[model samples]
Structures are given as C-alpha cells and as structure tokens.
Target: MAEEKLPTRAEDFAEWYNQLVVRADLADYAPVRGCMVVKPYGWALWENITSWLDGEFKKTGHVNAAFPTLIPMSFFEKEKEHVEGFAPELAVVTHGGGVELEEKLAVRPTSETIIGHMYSKWVKSWRDLPLLIVQWGSVLRWEMRTKLFLRTTEFYWHEGHTAHVSEEEAKEEMYRILDIYERFCFEEAAIPVLKGTKSETERFAGAQITTSIEAMMWDKRALQSGTSHYFGDNFAKAFEIQFLNKDNKLTFAQTTSWAISSRIIGAMIMVHGDDNGLVLPPRLAPIQAVVVPIFKNDAEKEKVMEVADRIFAELKTAGIRIKMDDRDNVSSGFKFNDWEMRGVPVRVEIGPKDVEKGSVALARRDKPGREGKTFVPQAGLDSAVSDLLADIQASLLKRATEYRDANIHNVEDFEELKQVVQDGWAFSYWCESRECETKVKEEAKATTRNIPFNQPDTEGTCVVCGKPSKRKAYFAKAY
Candidate 1:
C-alpha cells in the first residue's frame, strides 16, 4: 500500500495535497459533501495542537466552556454587520423532530452572536469586567468549495471570546493572543509567520481591528493561519452588555475574539512537506519517533527485537512519543516508507548487525535519503534522539524562514508589483483605500494579506494610486 507514488507537488500541487491527506491516513471525505472525517491519526495531531493552545489560554486566565450548537436566528439580527458577513454561509434549521419550526436556528457559523447574548446576562457589574471564555467545537458554514483540512462546511477549532471594561484592555487581549499564535507557529509548528493588522476591507465584520499571522506556503501563496479581532463596543452595544463603571455610570463592554483552526495543519503540510512526504516538526508530531526492528530470519528477529524494544522503552521513558513497528508481514523497506509518509520526526532502526555493534541507525525525517541517516551508539541513545529532534525542529524553521524571505520582493511601481505577485509576494506601500486594493485584486489576482507592523521609518507613495502611504502591505494570492 505504501508503494504507490503521489503526484509531485511541482507537477500538481493541488492533487498532491488532496491525495496525501487520505493516503497518509490523516482524513477522508465524508458521505456528506463539504465535510471530512478526521481519522484517529489526524485527530491525535489535532489533540496535540489543542492541548498546547488550551494550556496557554488557561495560563492567560481564560476558561473553557461549551455553548449550544443551535442558536436562534433572531440572535444574528442583533449585530447587523456580523449577520451580513455570514448570511450567505449560515446553515439555517427550519425543521426539528419532523415538525416545521416557526423560528429558525443557525448552525453555529461562529459563536460571537450567541456568546454576546450570554455575556449580556452574565455581566452586569464592574466586578465582572473581564469575562474570558473559549469554546472548543465544530462550526457549520455551508461552504461551496472544501478541502480536507483547509476549508470545510464543518470544521474544528477553539474560539475565544473576552469582554473587557475598556477598549485599551480589549485591544491588548487581541494583540496578546496574536503573539501567542505567532509563538506557536515558530516554536511548536516550526513555521515562520508574519504578524500584522488586516486591511479595513479584510477586517472581520463589525470588528474595529483585525490582526492575523500570515505564512507563505511552498507555492509562494499566503495562508492566513490565525486571526485575532478587537470588536470595541460593537458586540456589547448590540447585545446590551452593560456594566456600571467605577464612577457608577453604565457603559458597554469592549470585546475581543480570536482563533487558530485546524487549517493550520494544512499550513504545516505545505510548509515542511516534500515530494517524498510530510516532514513534521518534532514538537507537534503525534509520533515524534518510530522504532523499526530489521531482520532476515527468526534468529535475527529475536536479536533485533530485543534491542529495538529496549530502545523504544528508553525513548518513551525520556518523554518521547515513540512507536514500535515490528510487523513481520511487511518488508523493512515498507515500514520505512510507511513511517516516512506519516512524517515521524525520527526513525530508529536496529538490525542484527547493529545489535552486535552496540549501535542503531537513525534517520532524520527532515533530511530525507541516505544523507539523513547515521549510525549512533546505542548507549545513551535517548539523549541522542532528543538532540536530533531539536536540531530538526530548528532546521525546519530556518529553512522555511529563508524561503519566505527570499520570495518576498519589494516593489516600486504597480507593474513591478504585478509581476512579483505572479510568482511571489509583493511587499509595497499601499494607500489603505478600497479602490486601490480592489484594482490590484482585479488586475493581478492578489489581495492585501496584511499591513505588517514592521515597516520602514520613512514613508513612500502607494504602488497602485501614487498616493502618500504610511505602511507597507503584503500582496499575494491566498488560500
């Protein structure tokens, strides 16, 4: 089963991703269109992602809670902009238990409206100033086009909603979450990202400010990995979430919402994966290392298995997520290919010869083929494996960062910007006007990804309209 070769990314990037998702046992298409069934392997990967994020949220004083899946349609009307933004995608429920319902319900496209309504009732005094809650679940959007993990009608994520007494506090919360998200991408996922604020036209509906972490994929297209939005008093005013201040005056609460969804898995695959298969970061991979015993006969099998089992136990004791692949039905080569496809960060192979030599063959996933293989003493092998995993993690981040920097070209004019965006990202001065933004989208098929916080001390003219501009923005075709 591992013998079949996938289409090379250079030949067909889209098909390569589509086939790899299923062949790698991550997910499969469901009977329902626009939905996917995440297999156990994929769920384990997601579990690792959520576990890290959940811990970080708790450390920041946020608590987890669940809301009803079905929210009354009327709740959406409370926030006009939000409803308009999501109106086309909402999956409305008009019948329940075989009876036609008078009032319709919208499958939770997002929990903002419902969460706002609940916050209105829960928050009444200055003491309840900051209510930070996160919900972990799936949302239905009725998407017309869907990819395995990137986009789907129903997808998994954790949405965080927080209410603060002041706009300053709410905006701080928004930026704080974006910082955490950027760290997650760098340290855990080994994907370098740019953190910045979204353009007005791209900001979340009803949000005063929207920020995101953008990452460049292998194809040089940008993917919005995570987003954090500051809603000011929009939601609070709409939902009547009023509280008495220190001066005893009533005021609407300032709110923020942020999320990092499963689409991040797609980002990882595109950033670190290769023609061979996935090259997962050690910190986030479900199986950090896999142990395979190589043998030709029963005698060899016994010797190899003894060493392999001991090494697996040692690695597991050292806090490594290890797997023992001692299947007799398949060839050792088959096991290697199988684990390679799964993107286990490290592979430990102990054959009879290695057992006799008191050594094991270590293969690094990030560096494929013989170049990545080495013979290391089995003594203190656990430390050796740990060090290798760390190196691989660092190496992935370095490689991806270099690639991203190399592909971003600064443009001095509209024609140059058009050419740059065809094969890479165009970093140029922008007027931050919808007219200029739309012109680029219409002509070059690129949109403003974000206005990066890191900008030149000196201002320049807009590339599109030649208007005075204060900041530079990334223009790219996005996922």
Candidate 2:
C-alpha cells in the first residue's frame, strides 16, 4: 500500500499546520465555536507535559489548588488595570435558571481578580507570607481567532499565584519561575528560548514585571511559551489583602503569578515538527517507542513473534513505554507513516530477517534517514535507546537554538527594524518610552516582545529616534 502524503510546510505553513494537527487525529474543532476537542493522543501528550511540570512545581515547593472558572464582574472592577486588560476578552454569563441574573458574571480570562478576592479573606498575619499556590484548570477567553492549540477560546493551564511580604520577594518569584520555565522548555521540550521581561506597553496589566520565555517557530514567528509576572502589592491593595506584622503595622501583601498553557503544545508542533509529520522530543512523546512486526511464512512469523514478545517484555521491565503493532491487515509502511505523524520517538522493527540476525532495526522519528537505517543487536537495544533518546533531545534544542539566532536581527534604523520584524523578531536599542513604543508599533505591526534580562547596558542610540538608549529590546510579530 502507498503511504499517505502530508502537506508540505513550504506550500503554506498555516494550512500545513492545520492539516497535520487534524490529519494526525490529535485534536479536532469542537462543536462550540473557538473551542477544541483534544483527542486521546493529544490529551495524552498534555498529560505527559502536566505530569512533568507538576513534579517540577512540587520540587520548587509550589502546592496545587483548585479555583472556580467563573468570577463576578464586581471582583474585576476592583483592579483598574486588570479590568481594562481582560474586560475586552471576557465571556459574560447573565442568566441562571432561564432568568436574567442581577449582576453579570464574567467567565475568567484569568483568575487574578477572583483568587484575589479569596486571598483578602484568607490572609490574616505575616505567617501567611509567601503563600505559594498553583492551579491547573480551564480558562475561557473570547478570542477573535482560534488555532488548534495556540489561541483557542478555552484551554487547560497551570496558573500559579503567590503572595509575599515584600516587593523584592515578589519580583524574585518572577525570575525563579522564569528560570524553571526556560529549563523546562530546553530540557524537557527540547526547545531553546530567549528569556526576558516585557516592556510597560506589553506587560500584563496590573503587573510590575512580566518575564517570559520566547521560542522561534519554523515560520520565523516567535511563540511565548511561558510567562511569570510580579504584581507587587497591586492586587493586594485592590483586594484589601493585608496582614499585620509584629511591629503592629498593617501592610498589603505583595503577589506574583505565572503560567504555561496548551500553547506550549503549539510551540512544540512548530519547533520540532517538519514537512513530513510531527517530530517529538523523546521525553515529551507519549509513546516513547513502538514495535512493528514483519513476517512472511508461518515459521518466520513464529520466530519473529517470539523474539518480539521477549524484546517487548525486556523494554517494559526497563521502564520504557512500548507498543507492539501486530496488525496483519495493514502493511508496515502505513504504520510507519501514521506513527511518524503522531511522533513516536523511537521505533523497533522486528522481522524474520532480524530474528535470524539476532538484531532489530532502530528508527528515530526526529532524525529521519534516506539510506540503509541503523540497528542494534538484541543485547544492545536497551542501552541504544537510552543513548538515542538523549541525543534526540539535545538535537532538538540545538536546532531551535540555531533558529532563534537566525531570526533575531539587530537593526539600527526604524525602517530596517520594521522590515526585519515582519518575518520574525528584531532586537534593537530602545529608550523604554511608551511614546517611542507607539511610534514603532504604528509603523510596524510589531510590539516589544521583551526587554531581555541581564543584557549588557550597551551604549547605543534608539533605532527610531536616534536618542540614547539604555537597554536593548526584542520586537516581534507574535502568534
């Protein structure tokens, strides 16, 4: 049988992405507008991501909590900036029991306001300082445009809210989370990132600092994989979240919040997936390895099957996620294409030929080959997979690191900066002026993605106005 053909990315990246997402059967458009139905495969991938992230959070002393998805409009009105930033994207629920309610309740675009209301009632003393909590739940935003896993109306995410006694501690949480985020992406997802802080114009509303990890995709566009924000007593003041110290002084608590959502799935799709199909990092792949059997006659089949069974048992005992595909109806070629599309990180091929040779063919999804593929002797299968997985993980990170470098352009003039950012990101000396920011955005459909953290305080003129600039900032047209 002929293998199914996949859409070429060069033909149209947007269409190709859509085709790969739906064709791979990972997810589908939901009945309700702007929502997505994550299929078993897709949900399995998310589970893998969440399981890993949850452990990481626990290691950092962040406890998981639950929060409701609805928030009363009155709660939003308490924070001036939070209200303005999210009001436009809120979904209002005005009826209950088929009757109009007295007050409208906004479906959460975020939980800061609702969670803040609860904090006001719960916090009573300095001992409650550094209240660290995280929640994994669904959030709704009335998005104008929705992609499979990028900007859907409703998506699952882990949102963390922490309260501290001082602004410095609050800000410290932001950087700490940023570090975890960068390490997670590069180490687990195998996607390299540029870490930075958002400019005032682009910072989360009511946040004093917004730190982010930005990754470049195949389309030359940047995807914000994660963010950490410092509110610094802003929400505390708005919600009257105060505690009394031993000095007998009542002080509003400082707060910080951060999140990484299903959007990281989209980033992984764009970063590692190619024209053929999905190319997942081994650590993130739901099915780490699949075993496909090949046979000819009854004698050959029995011999291959016996070896396959033994090999599968050994791999499982070694703590590997292994699947045995013995469907006799379909040819092995079809299985190869399907599994490749779904991004099974490794494949073990056992056939009559391999049984006689006392070895099996090993194929890696991320690193495709055109010539005679490699194999590992039966005794070496376990060790070979361990080495291959580590190599693929590092390979993906190196590839993305190169893409990030290639897309980032440092322009000295406004006109060049505008041209450069159209395709991807541009870094240039910025004066940190909102008016200057507005001028740049007006001329180019780009915003400051971030003021890079710990960048050299280079002495250079602003790309737009020729005035002295203190720091360099990354500008990009984002997803």
Give the best candidate by TM-score: 1
> Candidate 1's residue-wise lDDT over 1-479, tens digit each?
65578789999999889888887789999999999999999999999999999999999999999999999999888888998899899999999999999999999999999999999999998899799999999999988899999998899999999999998899999999999999999999999999999999899988989999999999999999999999999999999999999999999999999999999999999999888788899999999999999999998888888888889999999999999998899998888888888888999989988999999999999988778899999999999999999999999999999999999998979999999999999999999999999999999999999999899999999999999999999999999
The stretch of ten residues in a row with the least summed lDDT in candidate 2 is 367-376
Query: What is the TM-score (0 to 1) of candidate 1?
Result: 0.99
User: lDDT per residue, candidate 2, 431-471, as tens digits?
Assistant: 99898899888889888888887677557989888899988
Question: What is candidate 2's CA lDDT for residue 301?
Answer: 82
The 0-to-1 C-alpha lDDT of every candidate, in the order given, reads 0.94, 0.87
Error of 1 at 376 (Å): 0.7
What TM-score does prediction 2 earn? Answer: 0.97
Give me the displacement of residue 427 in model 1, in angstroms.
0.5
